[model samples]
Target: MLQRGGAHHRRPRAIERLVGAAKPTASIRALNFASNEMLFLQTCDIPSDITSTEALGWIGFDNTTAAEIFERYIARPDPTINPADLLQYVYGHISRLLTSNLRNLPRVQAMRVVGLNKPIRRALLDPCYDQILWTQDLHFWVKDTLKINYATLMQLQQQLGNYIHQRRSKQKQKPASVHGMSVVPPPAAELRHWQPEHTATVNMIPEDHNLPASHVTVSASPPTIREGHLMLYKGRAATESINQDGPIADDGSISMEVLSTCPGGDFNWTSPAQYWTPEKDVAEQFRRWAEQRCPYSETWLLAIQLSPEFARGLKREELWFSRDWKEYAWYCKKTKQPLSKFNHFWNDPPAGADLMEGHICTGVTTAISRMKVEEIQDRIDEDHVLQVGENETKAKQCVFLSAGAINRLGREMRGKLHIDIYAAIQSQEFSEGLEAIALK
Candidate 1:
């Protein structure tokens, strides 16, 4: 009776084995995605050398300069560096380029806003850089320079696939490394404490602990501070300012102490600390400091400290949107830094369109929503633009939502929203929408 039972089970056991063998593993899926990306890249007419001055003008880089910069970084190294580390280094390098008044310039500021990753102040002395770089401006730069955007995307994906495959392959050989499991452990919920209110939206914010994680547009928005007499001062000034003017006395000047008088030895500047005042004299002083690349004075630091308060005191229209200000605010909030260190990027017109959104979090949304390609939610997918709706300026504009806001809207709203990213990419609209608004 036992032998007969065993004989009857053989066919079913064979069918089960075949089904299990046919299933794709994580590594296999990654490679398949990477292959498709590589194919798409091969079809593009990527320039080896671009000589068009018109194209070069958009990013402030000449053809030769752009090509050199692109080539220097585009190629894979003999010994590959981790993708995460490379991305971090690139971000820091670009951040260094924004010195002095450059951060306040609309074009540069726009680029910063478009770049992914919120800035975290590492310390007082260390140069603050965001952890990664993901910006549509970079795509424009690559397209203008005639470099391979596709390669970068594919390389990252390929390396990730290899990593996963290697780990999976070694499960039996190195059981100790795997902690005796047949597969690697799932990613830790880094956002567990900070998840959105909705249980369904818990996975909405993609997080992968596994992988390590541009631009040439010259569109000029209005400057945050108009050309005027800027007073640099120490001590307290009324945080409130009327009209477009900051806190200023009747003569358009304010008193501020000298940087040398400050308690900190870290700053080397000896000039009178600048205050947030308007006057030709103060403006000239700012110009001089910016040109000289002088260390920020105590009053300047005070100005930064009080900028948020001053902005809050102003009417909605009086406040100007600045990329640095928003980024700084988000960073301070994330780190639990005091309000004195925070600066806000207020929408001058008091509109949602002007502000950028923060990444989803369980704790809180720090910034406004930004529109990027839906594929950016996960880098594995091929990047392509979606068709803008009849009245919409950009494609799939509804997905970027704050956790709190989405929860309040209720869960039923979730089923109503559908993003057909793959379908969008496959459609003819992808090529037609090259000039679509960049992901903020």
Candidate 2:
């Protein structure tokens, strides 16, 4: 033990405690530097200078991030980590950190969380994983199954919470917001004469509450198994098909297994073959619901729910809701797609023709749902798929929009402009609002 340097801090409690923990040993091996963080260590500017490699004692390290964090940490040569001892380091280091500030600890009984069943993978990257970690679901599962103490679980949660917040902050800092018609700016040549009609690009997506970004419905949700190209479960006759009765884009039998109606599910929410008619009882019900939720038109539902960004739009209160294909088809014309695939431009649009009437001018009608969004949240999991119903064999009649379909539409909508409700309003205030926003 060689003690060469000396330090004198006027307020030296923190530094003394950290550097002077051992009475006999001079060269310290491993030490908890939480005190130094909370109160700067007066002993030295750099804390790493106070530790010895042999004393840093190898501990088990479990990485929440798949490779970015776990691999990167382990890969680094400075802090050599042994794979066998990684998990130990994770538990010990996190536990130590949790104890730094406990002035007003909860008076509740101490409950301890033993550990996760599996190594946390894709901590921040995977939505399904994030949901489990953030919610009490995973903690309770670990507690019930492993009988981990409740107190321990709380600390674990705090640790995860702090870590997640840190990652999100870093993520937010790196990406600058993109604002314009296009989600990203076009090349320099195109920018030379950028016009309002030119799609602007925005880098940041508003935080989505209706559907969590991580809850990837496409990857996580069960696939709809199909037997043939044309779906056999064409509940409606060929004549009663969509107004266009266009060529069937897909002809395949849906896997009857995954199509189960939610238990106690209201049949009224079932998909309608055509657009809503105000005279219809269902339409009136929607009207009343809309009348209560927003100050503006309820018929907006018909307009808003058509885009691939329907989920995002809904959460942001951006799109109008549509009840049937008519309103949905009408709204798509506003989107900036070459084919207006969401509208008539697609060869197989539900409506028979292309909507020359671009985005609906403001003061247009919208629909409101009798059901609250919370109700939908209760019925569907983060994956945006309805929970497996009591009867697995029976296929669900119709969904407002299935996970697969939404993913497909979104994939199609990427880089394509749909009508922007916000811009359309400005145009509506003036005559020839449509031409003003259009590409010359």
Candidate 3:
């Protein structure tokens, strides 16, 4: 019976040798171990009663069977070995088989060896040696199967760590401010100049009480990705001047010619009669002009331009604009109340409207009127208190002018033209305006 059993095994071994020696095509060599000969093995009449498990038992190989074999091999008198040594042996063997089969190399060759000492030390010789060994085997199998190397695996690990850290850092960051506060970095590329056509209201107010008065608010809504130069203009005078010219020049200069007429000089300059009346009407007229002319222009305004020195002094310096005209108007809204009656009249008022009428008349007069009411509301909502007293005080001291022109003026005047605008404007309007203003 023993000889008969031995003879049966020899028959299978002979068949295996024949199959191994057969000249396989390139495609057949590429076939995986589970696929190439599994069907043929199944088709062969080894035994009708034998299951795959039984067959594996007969052959002394399978998932658990391989581990058992490895354990038995490790349990010799020389079994006093590091678990990683055994793991290295298994990994090396599998890697060799995979490379040899996939590459269609000679039947057998010396396998590539990978050092496990470093990894074993890194794993700290934990009690979960079996789990670690299994994991390493799986890793080696995948690397060998995919034809990758240790260096590639290490690189993948490093990339995975970086990705995880980045995600965690983003999650841990504070949320964006609800008040629309953002700390934007300075633009790195050349920015498109702000266009007047894109203008949106930040505040508005009516020409009512002289105490707190009506105010209209305007703010800039910058694009998601902004580049190039930016300008921010505070006070109605500066803003109106910017609207007339187009978006402020990158260096903050306003060209008198550009202000007088539209680009290409196609549109004739028509100073709206109602716009330049009583000084109280200035704010409303400016709003109307901005709405009519500023929208659709290709320019970008930076909050920094409005007050450069103030922006520089900020803890988180960034260019931004407000967009709360409705809120501002609501805050400024008031019911009719008794007031001291006053009377005034005008004559030959800029070639439009009766001086006694004291009302602005223009194509955009309605928009200006509504904006004036909103501006007063905004101040009332803000409690008529200075939000940034020190910054406001400093900004008042600084003058609004083209940065490039300022530099040029300084160079021409040998830095003698460093006087602030309120002082200069008080002394002489034309000289101060000429000294500071320029066109792109």
lDDT of each: 0.22, 0.23, 0.23
Tens-digit lDDT track of model 3 for 1-440: 00000001122232233333222110011011112221111011121111222222222133464454355445545545544443244444445444434334321121222222222222323332222122122233233222212222222222223323343365454432212433221121211111111111111111100001111111112212224322322211112221122222323232223222111110111221111111212322232222222211111111221134333322221111123322221221211211211111111223211211111112111122235443543432222221222242101112212233233322322111110001111113332343376431
Models, CA RMSD each: 24.8, 27.2, 39.2
Off by over 4 Å in 3: 1-247, 261-278, 285-440
Return the top candidate by TM-score. Answer: 1
Task: Estimate the TM-score of every prediction.
Answer: 0.22, 0.15, 0.14
Ten contiguous residues with the weakest lDDT in model 2: 202-211
Clashes of each: 19, 62, 48
Model 2 per-residue lDDT tens digits across residues 1-440: 11111111132342234333222111111111112121111111111111122112111112232222244335546654444333333333334213413212321111112222122212212332322222112222222221112221222222223323443465553432322222232233332232222211111110110111221111112123223211111111111111122111122112222222221122112221212111222222333222221111101111111333443332111122233222332223222122233332222324322111111111111111222333433332223211122341111222222334433433432212111111111112332333366646
Runs with alpha carbons beyond 4 Å of true place in candidate 1: 1-43, 46-62, 70-89, 108-152, 155-419, 422-427, 430-440
Weakest ten-residue segment in model 3 by summed lDDT? 1-10
True-vs-predicted CA distance for residue 222, candidate 1, Å:
41
